[model samples]
Target chain A: MFRAYSALIRKEFIQVSRDRNMLRLIFLMPVVQLLVLGYAVNLDVKKISLDVYDFNRSQTSRELVDAMKAGDYFIPGEEGQTKERRPLWHLADRFQDGSAQMAVIIPEDFSERLTRGENVTIGLMADGTDANSARIGLGYTAQIVDRYAWKHTGLSPPIGIRSAFLYNPETESVYYMVPGIVATLLTMVTIMLTSMAIVREREMGTLEQLMVTPISGFVLLMGKITTFAILGLLEMVIALAVGVLWFGIPFVGSPLLLLALAVLFLISTLGMGMFFSTITSSQQQAMFLAFFSTIFAMLTSGFFTPISNMPQWMQYITYLNPMRYFMTIMRGILMKGAGIADLAPDIIALAVYGSVIFSLSVIRFKKRTE
Target chain B: MNDKIVVQVENLTKRFGTFTAVNNVSLSVRQGEIFGFLGANGAGKTTVIRMLCGLLLPSSGMGKVAGYDILTQPERIKRAIGYMSQKFSLYPDMTGRENLYFYGAAYGLGRKLIGERVMALSERLSLREFLDRPSKGLPIGWRQRLALAVSTLHHPKILFLDEPTGGVDPAFRRTFWSTLYDLAEEGATIFVTTHYMDEAEYCRRISIMHQGQIIELGTPHELVKKHRAANLEDMFVDLIRKRESDNA
Candidate 1:
């Protein structure tokens, strides 16, 4: 069985090595995506253009106006000095049209309310059509204004915000995004290529030729898993290097722990793929299922948002996702410098998924006479 | 006589829920004989081969392939049999040598055995020069011959060829027949299916399956004599017409 499985694995490696494009995709595409996403895709919104609709020309309103421009998040732009009372709507359109992203509306009563020492709530109209961008912009605006008011007013605030952000310290998008993208990339390409190899054989009518041989399901699955695990590992290494050196994200975990976790992740991922292949009759079905499995992995896998932020029920559902634990292991190692002792639960979860899926795939493949 | 029976099927049936593929049927293939299975498309020749190869479970009844119980020794039968499909199954990107190597390895032959057998098979298949070139670039004739060589690499006792010579030139088809005879001479049971009537003439005995039931089974001459037909194709037409007439 071992000899048969090793032979099968070797055959898979030969097939993968011959295709230069697959090799390039397994390594290069992940690295490029990791770098581009790390540098460009940020949770903190910067350079948000704000159109000022300042009807209050008093010194207090001017101070509010000055507060908006004090941070990198809010860049003060065209001030509409119009007699029209409804200039705020027109300014909202400009924000929608990309001239600005956020519109700051200063009420005409702003100067009088501040002199009376009453707290003035400044209206911030953000286009929440794209909610993520809008939320980031809104948070930045609130933070900057609070700081400016306390600094300029000579009012020593009684309380300060003591915020403890969880997971990522630098709030670097790379630290969070790299793990998810790696999972997605490996799941996408490794499955497509591995599953497609069988599909093509069936199309070519060569699968029957292989099936008739002494090779059993155990041998075939082992070959597929080993070959894909190597490719998945290779891709992870390349993506990790780019994440570490190019993006300057720290990789502070033990290499042995990372390697061990990756094996469990690849097994569960490839095992699911082989199960899909067994059910799928054609390349189209394989491709469709591969796409379906990974999108849910990306959206629900807690790579972008806090899984804790999800409802309690959704958090329970995500436990079934092998990708969720893989992302946990990846982020734990890559970002927080977590060790094996800290990640024992995640390791056990991945092991369960792998053992179940691998066993199911092997058991599912019936010998023709049976 | 019992030793002569390489495969024995008794009232074998295959059904998918409500649909019946291979109806209750019994058949046997003799050792060291060219058994021809002839039928129109969708007549379940492929289905029977799959069942014999342990690809699908029979709905009812039982069978034995190569002296092993179908249910108990399926893995053994799988290891013991060779199958050449109608469709060209060779990988397009791998050279003839590479494909042969992969298939050989898949059969669980180690490095030394694979090397020796590939060398021997390549020379016999006359693919020595082109083994380094991908199978896709080879002509249809060489491709079919190469596929046959790969299928029989393990020297299985019973070889099933499902329309193995669809696209080969007539000359290679003749050469293919000669190779089948050579393998048969070595006491290998060759069970082949084809739409071609002339190929049926080369078989020691033949069976025609229609809608999953074996309608006619005999030596080629005996079948012609029984139907009082000029040739196998006309005999098949006569049988089909008789069945239609009987159904009506």
Candidate 2:
């Protein structure tokens, strides 16, 4: 069995090497996608255009406007002023036209209220179409205004809360996004490549020839999985290099642990590819199925949104997604410098998922061959 | 049953939903004989070959290949046979040598043996010049011959060829049959299906099927004599016409 499997692997590698385009794609796609997606998936809403409707021509209002402009998150937009002087109405137009993502309206309290020790209110309107950026923008706005009020009034609050971001001090999206991209690229490439391998053989009529040979289905599947697993590891290394070297994303974990975990992750993904190939009769069907499933897995893996924010049932559904555990492991290791003890549960979940899926796929492949 | 009877089938049947592709088809071939299976399109020739090759299970019946039950010992049967189809099965991107090496290894032949076999087979089939080139770029005749060489790399006890000579030129087709006869003389049972009636004449025994039933089975000369037809092709047409008239 080992002899046959080794021969099969040699053949697969030879085929892959001959196809220069596939080899280029296998390495090139991850680097390109990682650089592009790492920057594109930023959740930090910076350079948001801010339209201001200051009814009060007071020093306090001027200070407030200056404070909003001090932060990198908000930029003063030209649309805040109009010849007709209907700034409030124009604010709405700015939001509709996408000229500004946020608008601040200050009332006509001519600084008398602050001198008299009366509280003043500021009206803030943000486009809620993109809930994520809206929420981040709202949070930044509240922090700036709260600090400005405290500084101007010279009053220390009776109670205070100080928040510090751990692991990623600056809240750089690339720091959080790079690991997820690695997981996703590994899953996508491994699953897509392995999924098409068998179906391609079937389509070319080579599978029937292979099936009639003395080789068992298990050996054939092992050969396929082993080849793609190595390829997946190579892709992961390339993606990680891009993440760490190009993007400057920190890799604070043990490289050995990451390697071990990546192998486990590849088992599940490669198994999934094999499963898709076995169930599909054509390469097109295999491609569609792999794409559909990988997309769903990436979405539910908390690559972008927080799983904690999902509905209770949906969060439970994520328990079955292998990508979820892999994403957690990746982020935990690369970002948090988490040790094996800290990631025991995630490691166990991945092992279980990988073994179960791999076994099930092998069984299905055998049954299909029979 | 004689020990020399390499393939034995009794009432082998296969059904897809309500339609039967092969119904109560029974046949046997002895060791070292060239057995030809001839039929019209969709006449269940491929289906029957697939069953005997252990690629498909019979809905009901008893069939054995190389002393292993088709239903229960499919893996064992697979180990004992080689199959080539009308559709060229060699990897188009891989050179002929690479494809031969792959199949040789797939059948668990060692490196040294595979090398030796590849060298010998390429020489015999005059494939040495084209062995380094991808099979796709080679002419169809060379590709078919390469596919045949790959299939027989392991030298299985029984070889099943489904329309193996479907598109080969006449000169190459004659050479291909000579290879089959050589293999038969070397004690390998050849179970082949073909559309060319002239190729059917080369088989020691031929079975003509129609609408999922074997209407006639015998040596080419015997079938011609029994049906009172001028040749094997006429006998085939006569058999089909008789079946149609009976249905009418």
For each candidate in turn, give its C-alpha RMSD to the true structure in angstroms: 10.0, 9.8
lDDT of 2 by residue, B10-116 (tens): 99888998999898999999999899999999999999988888888789999899999999998898878889986789999999998888888888888899999
| True interface contacts reproduced, per candidate | 0.75, 0.73
Output the lDDT of residue A46, model 2: 71
Tens digits of per-residue lDDT for model 1 on B1-248?
12589899998888877877888778999899899998888888988888888777778878999988776677889878888887787877778877777787777777788888888887777778888887888999888888888888777899999998987778989989998998898899999999888999999999998878998899999999998999888998888878779988
lDDT of each: 0.76, 0.82
Poorly placed runs, candidate 2 (over 4 Å): A44-164, A367-370, B1-3
Worst 10 residues of 1 chain A by lDDT: A158-167
TM-score, predicted candidate 1 vs. hidden true structure: 0.81
TM-score on 0 to 1 scale for chain A of candidate 1: 0.69
* Candidate 1 wrong stretches, greater than 4 Å: A44-171, B1-3
